[model samples]
Target: MLGIAAAVLFFIAFLINAADIATNDTFTSTNVMLIGLTVLALHVSGVGTGWGSRGRRR
Candidate 1:
């Protein structure tokens, strides 16, 4: 899920940069890209993955 969200953010950032869309300081392409990177990092680190749900069997 987070990976998908990051991909969307990256796509939005690319569109904003490619189209030269005017945005507020808070909504800049660089900022959005950074946010996407953070989400990607979290996804890679298994933050939102449900791996912890499985119990270990002896």
Candidate 2:
């Protein structure tokens, strides 16, 4: 679930950057990249979650 959220945010950021490139002469993508990268870091580090439910074992 966390991974899915991160992926969605990243995709949105990517689209924003892409649109900027397609419609303008000035290139600006740093803020979106930073937001996406921060989420990536959290997802990779397992800060809040990454482990499945702890109540069940199979």
Candidate 3:
């Protein structure tokens, strides 16, 4: 529940920033892709560590 709430808040904040940048013509596809890649990398790293720890515990 907390994770979902945080994700919702994050998405809302992202939308607000996106709207502001879009209005100013400052939002580029490259920037969006880079941000997406960064988030993906962080998620993968976190999940990998979590799974690895679980395997080691067995």
Candidate 2: worst-modelled 10 consecutive residues by lDDT? 20-29
User: Distance (Å) between predicted and true CA of 10, model 3?
Assistant: 16
Give the C-alpha miss distance for residue 49 in model 1, angstroms: 0.5
Candidate 2 clash total? Answer: 0
The residue ranges of model 3 lying beyond 4 angstroms of the native Cα positions read 1-25, 47-58
Please tell me which predicted candidate would have the highest TM-score against the true structure: 1
RMSD of each: 1.8, 5.1, 5.9
**Where does model 2 exceed 4 Å of error?**
21-28, 50-58
Where does the lowest 10-residue lDDT sum fall in candidate 1?
48-57
Q: How well does candidate 3 score on lDDT at residue 19?
A: 70
lDDT of 1 at 13: 100
Residue 6 of model 3 has an lDDT of 41
The TM-score measured for candidate 3 stands at 0.38
Identify the superior model by TM-score, candidate 2 or candidate 3: 2
- In the range 1-58, model 3's lDDT, one tens digit per residue, is 3334445546655775667655333445445445555555666557433455445455
Ranking the candidates on TM-score from highest down gives: 1, 2, 3
What is residue 52's positional error in candidate 3, in angstroms?
12
- For all predicted structures, in order, the TM-scores are 0.89, 0.51, 0.38
Residue 20 local lDDT, model 3 = 63
lDDT of 1: 0.97
